[model samples]
Structure formats: structure tokens, C-alpha cells
Target: MTEQQRKDYFDKVDKNINEFGYHLTNVFESKERPSFFYSTGIYKSFNLPEIFIPSLPHGLCCEIADNYVKAFKDKRVVPRNEKLQHLSGRFPIFLIDVPTSRLTDYVLSSVWYYKDGNYEYVQVIYPDTQGHFPNDAGYDYDQEILGEFRL
Candidate 1:
């Protein structure tokens, strides 16, 4: 997408988030959820399997929606779109909220492409926070952090 188109897309997504709020419950309930699913051809052609994150219900959608809004507002759509295009339809998305301090020191590569004997899958992890919480086991810094306990 061109730079302007990317910005426009981000703006559109931000408007959606602002109108709907960055609530996962709402994101999931929205009629647009079906579009997020990959086409059978996409999987078959790319050998992309259903992706799964070991973590569950970690509010990754909220983070993504929130980031889109922030990117639009900050006028950072170009870089944002570049990163997003690489991620789009690449992972099924699995997330979990563990204390950052509790997370393992392991590299924890969140996005992976895997294929084995007629099986394939891509996984991606979106952290809710972008701040420095290296001590916490699995705190996402990309989230809005609405409150101490809320992202």
C-alpha cells in the first residue's frame, strides 16, 4: 500500500476502535470478525497451518486495535503498516497474561512459521504494553494500561 493508503487504513481502523472501544469482547462480537479468518487457499498455498500461542486470552486484539489508533494519531502509519503487513494473516493469535517478572528469560519468539508432513502453522504474539517491564514474566507493553490491572 502507498504511504497515504496506509495512513488512511490506520485512520479507518482507529475510527473503528474509537467508535467501538478497544474491548476484546466487542472486537470478537463485531460482525467483521469473520474477515480475520484466512481463506483455505491461503493456507494450502502457503503451507500456513492454524497458528496457536501457548498463552490464551491475553488481550492481543486489544493491543492491536489500540496500536492502530496510536499509529494514526502519531502519524506513524508507514512503519506501522510495514510491520503489520508482515504479520497479517500470518498467525492465528494466542496470548496469555503472565506477570512480566514471572516470564522465562528464554527468547520467547512469539511469531513462528512451521510445517511438518502436511501440517503448517504460523503463530504471532502481541504484547499489550511497550514500556519497560522486563522483570515481569509476560507483561505486554503495547497495551493502553488503562489502570494498574487493566491494559
Candidate 2:
């Protein structure tokens, strides 16, 4: 993208963040990894850690994320490091702290927009069909397939 195009892209992102509490970005899957979507501006606006979900269908991810932002705006923040059924979805969400080292790989746009990496983040971890989390015994699938949790 040209410099002008890049400027316009960031401008749009800024507008979205200004209008809404956070901005949602969807990254399609590639050969190396599965698809993912994440939020930006949550920390700047609400002082709440940003969130992301991976491997689920893109549309579903967006729906859940939008709902999450909705709840967030409603002053219903998600609790971290525990099983949660607060968001609108069948799968309970577990918020795991996203290490600062991994921030560049996941939330680069957010960091760029804020011009800093001092903010905190939490990955919205989802469980398998049996409701078993990554750390649980008899967990059904690999954690990375959904999303990585680095605490």
C-alpha cells in the first residue's frame, strides 16, 4: 500500500475507535496459522485489556466480539483467568494474560495505534465441545488451534 493508502487505513481505524469503544480487526487464516480477530483501543478508552479469539469461523468470531464490546460498553467487563459465561455464546470464555513478548505477533496494530506496548491484554480462550479447557484433564484438542495462552 502507498503512503496515502496507509494513512487512510489508519484514519479509518482512528475514526472507528473514536466512534466506538474499540475497533475489531479480522485476520484471515494462512498456510502457517489459523484465522483470528482482535480488538484495539480498549485499553486506551476503557483501561481494560484488549481481547482476541482464534480458529473459530470468522463470522462467529465477529459476532461474539461485537457482543463482547457491547457488553464492555455496557460496563460489563469480562473477568480474567476463569471460566466465564458472561458473553453471548455457547462456549464459555476464559481470559488468559497475553504476555508482552507475544503482543507484537497478535496486537501489532493496536500497539502501533497507541504508539506503545505498555498496555495489558487478555486472550479470550475457548474450550472444546466437551467444555474442557486447555489446562484441564482430558481436554479434547490442541490449544493453539483455538488460540495460544501465554501467562
Candidate 3:
């Protein structure tokens, strides 16, 4: 995707977050990945898994979403649960559209765990073909964790 398209896509995502009453608390960007951390005013909001950080609820340090490199070799749509297996612990998960040049469309599901006072973010990229997570299909997935940092 062109630079303008990338900016436009993130703008839309920010707008959606505002519409939902959640606001971004921090943002991190690098050559290989970009991430957004968010929080809501509501009580008992989404939280990260305890295994990742036992002191906080999923919502307190929640990584609302992120984007990562698409590295699937097979090129097929993957089930949500299948993607979750690549994650370390249970927490709420949702898929979001991401801009990509490697595929026609990419859906990224994000979950977070707390580590070293920062959020260890995991994003499972579901491409139209050959998903980017470990699965029964036996495809080799080599991408590393996309982003991690404090909120």
C-alpha cells in the first residue's frame, strides 16, 4: 500500500475507536509493525490476560489493535479459534481490517498480555490465503511478535 493509503486506513481506525467511546492511550510504530493501546471510561473494561501480567485486568492495559507483517505462505482464510491458538492466553479477540500489499485483504486479530510493566502484543494476521499462524495445515509460520511496550 502507498503511504497515503496507510495513513488513511489508520485514520479510519482512529475514528472508529472514538465512535466506540474508547480512546488511544499510546502508540508505537516501527519499520515492521505498528500498534495502538486504548482504554475506555466504562467500568471493568477489557483487560489483558493474567498469565501475561497478573496485576492488571485485560481492559486496564488493553492493546485494542495492531498491525504486523503478513508472512503466510499457503494463502487461505483461517478460522478465528485457529488464530487464537497462536496466542498465549484467553482474552477477548476481534478482527480488524489492515492495509497490506502482500494480499487482497488482511484481517488482524489482536490480544495482549502484560510483561515487565508493558503490554506484550500479539496480532494474528488472517489473509485471504495461507494464514499467518500455526495451524493443522502444517504451513511454516515465521513472523515474530509484532509490537510490545508500555501504555
Candidate 3 structure quality by residue, lDDT tens digits, 39-150: 3211112232111111223353353221111111133232223334322233332222222222111112112111123222233333222442333355464432232211
Best candidate, TM-score-wise?
2
Residue lDDT tens for model 1, 15-133:
53355432122212245222121111112332223222322243543344334334343442223101243232323222222332221221111111111323322223443334223
Candidate 1 at 18: error in angstroms? 35
Instruction: List lDDT for all candidates, in order.
Output: 0.30, 0.73, 0.30
Alpha-carbon lDDT of model 1 = 0.30
Off by over 4 Å in 2: 72-78, 145-151
Deviation from native of the Cα of residue 138 in model 2, angstroms = 2.7
Range of the 10 consecutive residues with the lowest summed lDDT in candidate 2:
142-151
Candidate 1 regions exceeding 4 Å error are: 1-27, 30-39, 50-118, 131-151
Q: Count the backbone clashes (under 3 Å) in each candidate.
A: 21, 0, 10
lDDT (10s digit) by residue, model 2, range 1-151: 8999888878888998899877888888899777788888887887777777777777777777776666665564656676668664677777777765675776667877878546767777788889887777878975563235532
Q: What is the lDDT of residue 139 in candidate 2?
A: 81
Residue 138 error for model 1, in Å? 6.2
6, model 2: CA deviation in Å?
A: 1.6
lDDT of 3 at 63: 34
**Weakest ten-residue segment in model 1 by summed lDDT:** 106-115
